[model samples]
Target: MDTQTLKHLNEAQREALEVAEASRETEWTSPSFVAELFMGKIRTNLIFPYPEQSPEDRQIGDEFMKQLESFLKCNLDPDEVDRTGILPPEIIEGLTRLGCWGMKIPKEYGGLGLSQINYNRAIALVASYCGSTAVWLSAHQSIGVPQPLKLFGTAEQKKKYFPKFAQGAISAFALTEPDVGSDPAKMTCVAVPSADRKTWTINGTKLWCTNGLIADVLVVMAQTPSKIVHGKEKKQITAFIVEKGTPGIQYPHRCDFMGIRAIQNGVIEFKNVVVPAENILWGEGLGLKLALITLNTGRLTLPAACGGMSKQALRISRLWGKEREQWGAPIAQHEAGAVKLSHMAANVFAMEAMTYYASALVDRGGSDIRLEAAMAKLFCSEAAWKIIDDLVQLRGGRGFETASSLRQRGEKGYAVERMMRDSRINRIIEGTTEIQHLFIAREALDYHMKLVGAFINSQSSFSEKWKSFWKCAFFYPKWYLGLWCSFDWMKSYAGYRPLSSEIRFVGKNSKKLSRTIFHLLLKFGPKLESHQMVLARVVEIGTELFAMACSCSKAISLIRNNPSDLSPVELAKIFCKQSQIRIQHYYDALKKNTDPEDRTLSKKVMNQAFSWMEQGIIPDDGAGFQKNSETTVPLEEKRRYSV
Candidate 1:
């Protein structure tokens, strides 16, 4: 159960235990629902009353936004960039002059030192103007070398890199490879120390590395030799800073994407690249930890960007809905269009609520927001996607047409199609939707996992087992009883009451969610991880609850400050109503509609049991298999039939 006993376990088991222990320690101060959710508790302090920026910061942000608006409007062209697949140098120069790259870096380091909320707001504004520009700026700071270096780099490292970052030098974080996507443990990149140990020779290929081609500095992760730790040889993953002109670093090929086309992304190859010993970030075996920790706040960029996308979609949809008429009146008057418009606006409000709330937590600088960040990214990305889709639906044929095509044809130029394409990547990048669900589930179940792990660990002594068993026994009963009895312990976190009905609804469901999780744990016990379908539902419910809490809290804050304006309150009600329905749907699915048979069938199909279905199409061909040139169709016919 302790670190010393970890040697008796396998690598995966040891890692899991270490992670759980680290998370437990983090929760003591941060008190995130990531661990507490499994224990049937809502740490309301983490989410309620929302977060607010200082007046000084707000004033700075206002000025920054005005400057940003003028700069973006005067400089960037979304349509031109989408066509050219590159951002103009002048625009990058302009952004650099505006200090976009150094927004998060400390002022002492020659950067603006904006709070997380303001930084996020900046990203949202930049993203609204151009997705390509957003990616360029975000990649430079969000997960780029600046972030990891700022978080884990030594004082000397900061001194060396901060000024360059502030001057708009592009930086990138290279961790992904052709074979490694979500699982960094499976990374094949290797870093071997020289005999003198003065330098490390890194050899690896990184794929889909954002800004890989254009970055001045790169934070690269590679496997070092396994070190003997307490009689066990543990593989070490270390992070190193490799400068742009490093002798053996090469950008072999640029990668083209379906969207965010202006990103200078590609494959980066490291061939015996020598990095000085001082370049290793946070020492050996901590690369993954650094990457994750860096991403904690870096993840906020996507949600903020998504919020901007949603806002833009809402704007365009509104215009199209009002100006475009149907049989008797404008489409805005039609129930179908009205529903999409309302949902789009409501979702944008919810996204802003969630994004800023999470950003505020980051700015507050104490909470372990791993769960909150993931939830915001997941929810906002998917919501933005839906909102953009709705925008397209509202725009009709014009939505599908290229902005340039529309312009040339003397129609309104709108990037609805481009926006849809760009928005799709938000769900896929940083972490996929499915990946986020699994991650949230893992963190949410950490407490339970640790308890069960302790009880069942064969390496544990009899005393430890009994201790764990007793703890679990007492905890479960009390937790269930507390839920069933409708404990009001979290009321303080909700703040001054005579709470809005929407806020009350969120508070009520938080308990219901906790109770549902408890029952689910009781039913599944240690085998709960295998029930991913159920876990996904649980995560979804928690996401909705958090979103509701955020929306209601923000509304309440607005109402308290401005008493006359009720728009925030109304919007919160709409969002909460939608979230309430979603929570019920997920709760119902958890109880009765898990679709196990469908899952089993899907697994079977994945394993190729249904290969015969494509028998006549191509012999011995599997999925993704294509026919040779000998089996060809006419160009016209291909054009006619191609999807």
Candidate 2:
């Protein structure tokens, strides 16, 4: 499949492919350790003194945060909206008035034209207050019509759409279908071109289209007729900007979820919906690329939301841990509870570091950040889930109750339940955690794939094969030797000011990680993808390494700028120490683990070989298990007597 894909590329397309390949290669050869880390290659470099926000940018962020705070306080009641399962029209209007819709659009389009960091900050601020509002805002600009239009729309198209988008017109991204989630290759939606080629009629149903019910515009992807590529028929997907209320466009049903209830998500159907030729984005057959590019940055929103949720959890946990007493003292005094709080704080610090670093990379704009963005989304979402769960455990009974219910009972309420529900969706949306692991693993093995590709190509001459062999011979030994022997000089290349001993230890292990990855790639070759467990562990190691690097760099920057405050530095050190331990565990598991036996057991179970275990047990009926006692205490009575 890869061979065929590579064979059909034209010069320009091949150049683009080469550019991507070269960029991945540069990560290892260049001085950016973070970039190299994404490729599973750890080279010491000055990649992180932590990016600093310009004063002007800082001021803009401060002003926006201030305005957003006032706006949320005055116009939004998250608890009320959560109960109603709808965002009030007035709140949407308020967001529009606050320029939330235009936050990502450029200034020339009558929008805020905020930098990526500022944009993410804005998302975090709004998300902290209301998940639904954040979804609405992010859906509008992050992956919606505006983003693709900004990236690929013609000047005329921009002129036509930018103004409306700036004026608070809601937009949605419609890519997922009932059958399609991560794989667009399975898309069944069709866009048939008119005989004259002046228009195209789209017919499809998009499932879980966020903001679909309320969107004024939607960017939809559909399978166009196949185009011949190098004499072989190939599937072609196209993206179109379809205006709302277009002929045959209908919202057949509104979808509800476990979380983010205020979002106007639904199934959107386009039956014979005619879109003009000019509506096509970039060009025909570029839909997949456009979608991927949109998502590269679009995924950042999830991490920002994760960061926000973490902050909220940390604050709530700290207060509850101090105030809530157990055994004649604050629960926080207990070792178990104190450990959870510490982990929460450390993970939040790491999450913030990673999210901001990725955002800064986007704002910097010279390098490709597809890997960084995915890692951020993957790590932050999982971290936020664990952190929120800890918060729930910390609050005990109060965390299980809805905020409104607690408020009605005259107790200070925390939205831990709601936040937990909200955090779960982040793992599934944008990309599932499983999907992200696969994506990260694929990317991390780019160099190995290229090397293997050279050897496998049937078209390569004997001389070329010999050269490739020599290249590998030179590269592998040098790479491994560098990792082993370069420890003495690694610190000099460790970017900016000297790192603390703990951080230096992290750097040393990162080199070991890269060497281990290289050995795995050599051992597995093309069959490595089948070993999903090992691939997943490799991704885990890389993610932790990157997180540790970001945390340490951020701490160093904070300490340098504010020497008087060492608390942040300490937190960062703790996070890095924990990350280092995790990295070692993952690497060790990769070397010696029961994953193969686990896979065997899983396969046997799935194949129904465990029937003997269930032989005497009756299958569970549709009805769930009942309590031993028939009578259940009323909520009022329980609340009256519960601790």
Candidate 3:
């Protein structure tokens, strides 16, 4: 969109863009345009920041969990749990009683109307207790029912359907058919309209429907017509509310899954099932958008549950590592075991932080976040897989064998296997990882171009001069290429050189000399984490850095003077340092691959950290570290207070 930004492309960026535009020829799995520009590398220097939630939000999330724990303790009869599958009927009833299904439903519709933050916290708790139960709850409220209503349902539709969700009445979303899995465009579930256009006859089988076997209401997507319109084919997609006992609706029995077995998943054949026109959600042609919205929300939320599951596995691994000694000291003290623990901690923390950040953004309701959500989903899901694998390895022989009935080998194995299967589904479901890359590339390019265009537009007085400079600058193509290549190269090279360069730029261009304080903060970020203050300051620095970058681009548009003006340049310099410090803090908090002691401490602490997580304790809280007499907050509650 911004042509001036286009002019800023270094050679590597251009090359990457070229490669990405040609990605289809390479099975659409090549390195992304952004990757190519940044030398096919990721900058570990940049940290994604977790939401700086207010006390009210934290209290809300915490209080919600306290309520859950209370409900689980008071209402749920532990004896009702199926020891084999361990999915308690009382747990379901308790969730139903707690109004869990009404979490995201609007208050106007008789729901608690919790925000995204509350929803994630609840899901994490469920996932930690029982991954299957978590899946069951999330799959129903998240993917199965209210989502479609949110996207396509009319005001009347919302009024009618949303109220039912508060009752915890189960529903299933049917999209993946027997013949088609990821490709909804290829779906053959046809809903033919009646002669009077008042009703539609649905005919098709929906495969892999979670809660499909017993759902009281089903929201099914069907393709009614496919024909070319305005030189583009119009694919008529429609959704209908098919009650469980609809005349032509037939369940083909439960399709047993490897994991999440307690929650029934099955296929349903719609043999000329008849439904009223009033049931058509938001009318024809809106089904796909509704489905996409539902899927994207699920893609983002599912990973949060995965993060919890991974957290549980990591905790179990560390617990075993500490208790299960072999040869000499605890096996966890062994180097190999320690490495596994460290890697797991790093991944768990990163995924947790990332998921929260993404969720917060979604809650903010400003940014499109399609790309952000997809990236978070991709990273979090993949991280969960690796974390679980390492957990299994850390457990050794006992981990492989069935232990307690609650944590039996068959159940754990099936759950893990199911998670793996479901994990792959996320990659392909909303938009494949490859498709995500395309979106990421487009967004990055769009961002870059916007900056460039601003740079050009704001320089109206010197436009001719800049044009002349550019013409001569491009004459030496190699030099221009090298300039672009530098951005790519810097991504892979994590040394202080890039920071130093930014520092130099700031020092030269900064208007107020005091701005250098921010630059100094950025310079010490990596070192500070290496120091004892790894948990707090680093997060601040990462946040500063991201804020600085974003602010600098904004300043360029807002400021009148050009970069050539010393005052303008100085202002930009000051902003850059402030922003960089903020941005760098995010990465600093990532539970990184740090010193041996920090890593060890992080694992032990995070284990206890997780225990109190649903209770609202953060990782830096004292459960991982020793009690400090000097601090006002108890060691157990330091992280909770810090936020």
TM-score of each: 0.91, 0.89, 0.62
Model 2 Cα lDDT, one tens digit per residue, 446-480: 67666656675666778867877887888777777
Which of candidates 1 and 2 is the stronger one according to lDDT? 1
Clashes of each: 0, 1, 37
Give lDDT per model, in order.
0.83, 0.82, 0.58
lDDT of 3 by residue, 166-234 (tens): 887778888888776644556789999899988889998898887787787888989877657556545
Candidate with top TM-score is 1
Model 2 residue 400 CA deviation (Å) reads 0.9
Which TM-score value belongs to model 3?
0.62
| After superposition, candidate 1 runs with Cα above 4 Å error | 1-27, 33-38, 42-48, 487-499, 615-643
Better of 2 and 3 by TM-score: 2
Quick one: best lDDT, which candidate? 1
Model 1 TM-score on a 0 to 1 scale: 0.91
RMSD of 1: 3.8
Deviation of model 2 at 433, angstroms: 1.0
Stretches of candidate 3 exceeding 4 Å from the true structure: 1-50, 73-89, 405-643
